[model samples]
Target: MAIVELLNQDMKQAMKARDKETLSVIRMVKASMQNEAIKLQKDALSEEEELTVLARELKQRKDSLHEFEEAGREDLVSKLNTEIEIIQAYMPEQLSDEELETIVVQTIEEVQAQSKKDMGKVMSALMPKVKGKAEGSRVNQLVQKNLS
Candidate 1:
């Protein structure tokens, strides 16, 4: 099923199960997707576009999670963790380190990226292939490791 339909189905199940956290997270994601569609002036988002929205949402929560941890806000940290899990459930399966490294190396080769200076070229060629499957930072790190 398309992500939107899957989300709708999951939202109904969450409502039926009285899963407040899941329901809230689903609503938030749905709203984000809707907002993105409006911003693009599209009636619906393509699958890639949907993944972009999910990625943005996941990244925001993860960034917040890090800040909360640094601030020693345990309560908020736990809450954000839950939210992160909920958001991640809707994302594509993540790439393992080995797989991500392989792709990064291949992209670097494909782009003829010889050093960190070519990082932008490698990333531009790499991201679309690995989108929704790997975290951008992790990919960047792998690229750097292989480059230098």
Candidate 2:
């Protein structure tokens, strides 16, 4: 099923099951997807486009969780972590370190990234291949490690 259809079905199930956390997270995802469609002047987004939005939302929550922990806000940290869990359910399986390393190596070679100066090109070339399957920060770190 398409993401929108899956989301609608899940939303109904959440409602029937009285799953407040899941319902809220799914609602947020729906709103974000709709907003992105509007921004791009499209009536509906493809699954890949929806995944891009979902990935970004999940990243924001992860970032917030990090900040909450750093600030010693344990209560908010727990809440954000729960939110992240709910959001992550819709994302693709994340890449393992080994897999990420392989992709980075291939991207560096494909982009002819011989030095740090070519890091941007290497990253640009790799992002599409790894998108929704790997974290951006992880990809950046892997690329930097390879380039150096």
Candidate 3:
């Protein structure tokens, strides 16, 4: 099923199950997908674009989770973690650290990225391959670690 349609079905299930956390997350994701479609001047997004939207949503929650952790707010942290888990259910299978490392190494060699100066070149080439499957910060860190 198209991601949007799947989301609608899940939303109904969440409502029936009285799962507030899941329902809220799904609603936010659907809204984000719609806003992205509007920005692109399209009625609907391709699966690739839907994955991008889901990745963005996951990133936002992760960043918030980090801040909550820093603030020492366990209550909020737990809630954000739950939100992250709900969002993650819709994302592509994440690349393992080893897999991501191998890809980063290959990309570095392919781009002849000798040093940090070529970070952007390597990243532009790498991001498309990793996209929704890996976190950008993790990929960038691996790239930097390999380059340096």
Best candidate (score: lDDT): 1
Which pairs of residues clash in candidate 3, taking residues 3 or more apart in a chain or in different chains? none
What RMSD does each model have against the real structure?
A: 1.0, 1.1, 1.5
Worst 10 residues of 1 by lDDT: 105-114
Candidate 2 per-residue lDDT over residues 41-136, each given as its tens digit: 999998889999999898889888899999999999988888898888788899999999999999898888988999889988999998899988
Q: Write the per-residue lDDT of candidate 3 for residues 108-134, one digit (tens) a residue.
A: 999998889999999999999998999
Tell me the tens digit of each residue's lDDT in model 1 across 18-133. 99999999999999999999999999999999999999999999999999999999999999999999989889999999898888888888888888999999989999999999
Query: lDDT of each prediction vs. the true structure?
Result: 0.93, 0.91, 0.92
Error of 3 at 47 (Å): 1.7
Off by over 4 Å in 3: none
TM-scores, all candidates, are: 0.95, 0.94, 0.91
- Pairing residues by index, what is the TM-score of model 1? 0.95
Better of 2 and 3 by TM-score: 2
Of the candidates shown, which would achieve the greatest TM-score relative to the real structure?
1
Give me candidate 2's TM-score against the actual structure. 0.94
